[model samples]
Each structure stands twice: as C-alpha cells, then as structure tokens.
Target: MKRSNCLIEVCEDFDCSSKRIKTSFIEGNNSSKMFRNTIWYRSLLDAEKSCLKEDKLKKIHYKFQDDKEMVEEYNVDTQVLLRRAWKVKGKLGGEGKWDVEIGDPMPDATPHIEGIGADFMESKDQPKLTRRNTRINLEWRIRNLPYPIETYSVSANNDERCIVIRTTNKKYFKRLQVPELDRLNLPIEQGNIQCSHSFNTLIIAYKKPQQLLDMDKEWYLELNRVKPIKDIPNDCKTQ
Candidate 1:
C-alpha cells in the first residue's frame, strides 16, 4: 500500500534508521479462503471433521495445541530505508492504493481472527484489507519487534496520548517467540526495540492525520510513542 506520513521519512533527516522485518499474521475461518494461522488451524479443522466422521470411540479426546505454533511460512512485503526516504516505498514497489478504499482498517470493523482490530497499525496485505477491515479489507518492521502503535494528538496548546495497539490482539502481541529469526532476518528482542532504533532508525512508525487533537496519554505513551523514541544519531550506525 502507498505509505503517507511515513515514519521512516519523517525520522530520516533526524539520523534515524529502521530495519525491514517480515512479521507473520495468523487468520482463521470456516470458509475456504485462508485467514491468519489458517494452515494449522485449517489442519485442525480438517482433523476435527475427519475425527467426527471416523470416531467409533465412546468419548472423543483431543490434544492441546499451542496457539503460538510457527509451522508455516507467513510473511508480508516490507520496504524500510533511511527515514528521509519517504519515496523509498514508491521506488521499491511498496507504494500502491492504500487508504482510498472504504474497507481498509479503521476505527470501525470486525477484528481479525487473531484479535487485531481497532488498532490503527497498517499492514502490507492488500486482499485482506479489501476483504476484512473495511468491514472491508490490510507490514514488516525492525527485526522481530512487535510494533505497538502509539497515537498522539499534539498542537499549539494540548498534547495528548490516545492509544496503544498491535495489529491484532493475538499471540503476536503477547507471545512473540519465533524460531524463524535467522530465516526471516527478524531481530531477537521484542522489547529491545527502543535500544535497537538507537542504532538503525528512529524505530518509530507513525500513521496519518498528522493534525494533533486531544487524546489520552496514559495508555498511549505507555507504548513509547513519543517524539524521542531514541536518542539522536542512531542512523549513523548504518552509515
């Protein structure tokens, strides 16, 4: 999707750097169309159907499956560069029609199966957005860091913090363990994002509607969404 109010661009000249990360999403559904975590969940669903058909047992029993299983290869296209490179997304095919559609994720919509709804964070999945969030329709980020969106309202008078959100409210937000670190080149620390951004980019990603309105700060700033995510000169590490 075309990126505007890009976090990378706004923070670039500030000597901030950001790494491209491929984050996974798990969707579930009863239909043929896949949702995040469709693979394993689908398998379980099929197994459940099979067991029902073949069960000659008195009482049915099942094994407890971990919700955070990473047996599949799920990834989204990500294009990250110097914060000053707002055009970078366009140059690298990261640009496209994003916010124009009505189904795109917004304040209102059914949450993803993983529970990622009401969060303003955007993703790289096109068809998903066209289908899901728009009522509708849906990126990677640094390392394996789980980007918790923090929105704020700042203007001439009052500055307010509003929200703390991840794409969905699933295991991704709670449990971020992945064996595919080397495979996806995702960083190892889910909490070290602040320190990491000090070396690469600002490590901060902001959304559109730059206009500052009054918001809630306690919950919002708690996610570390502020002007100073990291100290200055973090981008020099890349140079």
Candidate 2:
C-alpha cells in the first residue's frame, strides 16, 4: 500500500470563567518520509500508556464493573492500539518535547468552602492546582495509507486526550467527506486514508472544563496527505 507522512496538530482552548473549551486537530505540512522516530510521537506514546494505566487503576478502585471483564476487554483493545507503535522502533528520530502552557493563571476566586475550614484553607493556598484558562499544543506524524478508516474515537482525561484510529483491510479508500475534515480545509482526495496498521497519537493539554466533557461536545479532525517531492503532481507541488 502507498503511504505518506503527515503532520497533525491538536490545539485545545479552555475558558475557566465560562467553563468552555474547544478542541481542534489542525493539518499541517507533510513529507514523503514517515516520522516514526520523533520525540513528539514517542512522548505521545508514553503519555497514552500512562493514561491507560491510570484508567485501569481508577476502574479497580471504583468497582463499577467486573474487573475480570474489564481486563479482558482492555487487553484486546490495547493490542489493537499498540500494534503500530511497536513497528516504529530503531529509526533515526526527530528532537523536540511536547509542550503544555497555562494561559492567564490565577487563584481560585470563590470564597466559600464545600468542606471544613481546614480543607478549604489548604485548597485555597495551592494556587497552581486551581483551574484556569489554558492552551495546549500537541504535534505528531501520521502515515496516510490507501485504506479508509473504519472506526475511530477520541476521549479526554483531565489534561490528556487519546485518539484511536482504526481501519479494516477490506475497505477501500474514498473521498473524505466528514464535516470535521472540511473545517480543516483538507482535501478528501489527498491520500488521507487509514488502515489497521496506522499508529495512534495522544495529546495531553490543560484540564478540560467539566462542561466541555459532555457527550454532545463537538470535535474537528482533518487528514492531510504526504507525498514524495518527486511523486507530487506539478499543480500540488510547493513553489
């Protein structure tokens, strides 16, 4: 299957006062070479593993579901997600760290304490722990193959977002027609396809507001193709 390396950027905007947050995946430049060995991608994988571990711990603590059943389910799920990650090892990689920045940091303005005065005082004293408006930027590389995506999902955990992309070998590549793709101005015919071998990328930003975590919240996604300079058509080539 033909493949190309594309850049993906997810920017999260959080507004503390209004309790609003917007998450967007921005399609950036592309190259013929796949960046499997970049620092950003490695960090993303590490963060994803951490998130999954935390999730497992939470499930064990809550006991909302059967532990045996949950473990079996996650075991299968982890295999699917990590299949591609294991293949990117032993390659020359890029350098750079994934960044997280807080915008307009401040103390909690609310005076009243929900618990005892001692607890309230301790909480109020920790300014850094208070929620505030923030922006998080995550960058990674994705290889667009000739197969179309079959199923995918994105979820947020406090400050991290996990993205899962899955496609079946039986499917054929078609024009990308999703509204989220249109919003990012990426062409459907840009070789933006996916298959089971595609790697999952994770982005962790500032904490998402509770209001924005509703099931109805909107998300934007775009897949841009990466092509070799020699293979790109003249019209699509950068001057």
Maximum-TM-score candidate:
2
Poorest stretch of ten by lDDT in candidate 1: 131-140
Off-target runs (Cα >4 Å) in candidate 2 are 1-28, 31-37, 43-239
Worst 10 residues of 2 by lDDT: 215-224
Give the deviation of candidate 1 from the true structure as CA RMSD.
Answer: 27.6
Report the lDDT tens digits of candidate 1 across residue range 1-239.
Answer: 23655766777745533322211122221221222133433443343110111122111112224321111111112111111100112346553221211112223343555555535555633112111110000111233333333321111111211212233444232211221222222234323222113222113222211111111112122212222223223121211
Global lDDT of each model? 0.23, 0.23
Instruction: Give the C-alpha lDDT of model 2.
Output: 0.23
Candidate 2's error at 152, in angstroms? 41
